[model samples]
Target: MKIVIIGSGNVSYHLAKAFQQNNIPVSQIFGRNESDLKFISDQLQIPFSTSKLNDADLYLICVSDGSVGEVSRLITKENCLVAHTSGSLPKEILAGNYRKASFYPLQTFSKSKNLDYKEIPFFVESEGEEDLELLKNIALKISKKVMVSTYEKRKYIHLTAVFACNFVNHLYARAKEISDSQEIPFDYFLPLIKETTQKIEILEPKLAQTGPAIRNDERVLKAHEELITDQEQLKIYKIMNESIKKMYEL
Candidate 1:
């Protein structure tokens, strides 16, 4: 299939790389930024254009959530399939007359980070069985896990991801801030963080939960809270502890 990938961001670069690795040729990369597109083109050896877009069997819109609709309207091609790679967006978000679909890869993407595409889960949705099967087949080539999920389910999946990945990472940043305040090496917490995540592989998060809050150790919690002079960090610490206490009925 002749494939044209839209956008030049992390998702775009990673999708193009995944396709190249699986021997699926992406016909072209289309975007507004010439430099970013050129970088992808140079790295993946795929032809790209800033002004002109090529007609292809499939157009994968890899732009941001806000830009998905605006970018989808740019594809003037008819009798082709157009899919966006957004976990939070529905296939209906694409405003074109063509077959609308979504080819969401459920993983955080970074251009510099190499990932095992086979380990990534792809959630695909389409208007018809033919198009849906087309997307599923493509996804199956690069990933071991591919599921047909509706927008209703996909949105919830995205929301859960925010809690699991984004919010958790933000907490890590806040923890680093606290460590830096005391001149404590943030790297010292690496093993703790790693073990915390690794434990989830074999244990339910609720059951695997640990810490002063989980234990409801008032003395330790009070001492830690007193040490956190930063109001924002203190607030977070208190809120998290309260939440943990409520969860465990402590």
Candidate 2:
């Protein structure tokens, strides 16, 4: 199957590489040079690169939310089967309201990491029965984890990812800053972070939760807050602590 990728960013690059690694044909990779097209081309060594969309068996548009409709229109309408690797986009946005599906991968991607698709859950949707099966089969070539997901479920999962991964990363960044200011190595938190994530896999998050939040020791919470001079960190601490307390029924 000849695949064409639209918007050569993180998702595009990774998907292209994963396909090629599995010996699946990626006919072309398209992107706006106004963004990160060339960089992806250089990394993936994708033979065909174009700012304008072209023809392929499967069109996987990985462009940003606002640009999805605009970029998708640039592709040939005859492909009959198309999918977007977006969590928040509605499935019907493409396929000319025909056979479209969401080929969303529910994992945070960084350009530097060598991703193993087999571990990442692929969320798929298709406009018709045939298209759904086609996407699922294609997805299985690279990933063992696949889910036939709805638009609303994908959106909720995206938001959950924001809170679980993105927000946690920001918290770590803040922790690093506070540690740096105190001449403590930010690396000290790495094990703690890893352990916290591991605990969630083995147990419920609320049960795994640590820190002053769960203790309900008002004095300890106050003392920690005083040390966090930054208003943002203070606010984060307060909100998170409140959440933890509520979860624990404190």
- Candidate 1 lDDT: 0.94
Off-target runs (Cα >4 Å) in candidate 1 are none
For model 1, how does the per-residue alpha-carbon lDDT over 154-240 read when each residue is reduced to its tens digit?
Answer: 999999999999999999999999889889999999999999999999999999988888877999999998888889988899999
TM-score of 1: 0.98
Q: Write the per-residue lDDT of candidate 2 for residues 153-197, one digit (tens) a residue.
A: 999999999998899888888888899999999888889888888
Against the true structure, what is each candidate's TM-score? 0.98, 0.94
Model 1 worst lDDT run, 10 consecutive residues: 209-218
The global C-alpha lDDT for each of the candidates, from Candidate 1 onward, is: 0.94, 0.81
Task: Score residue 185 of candidate 1 by CA lDDT.
Answer: 100
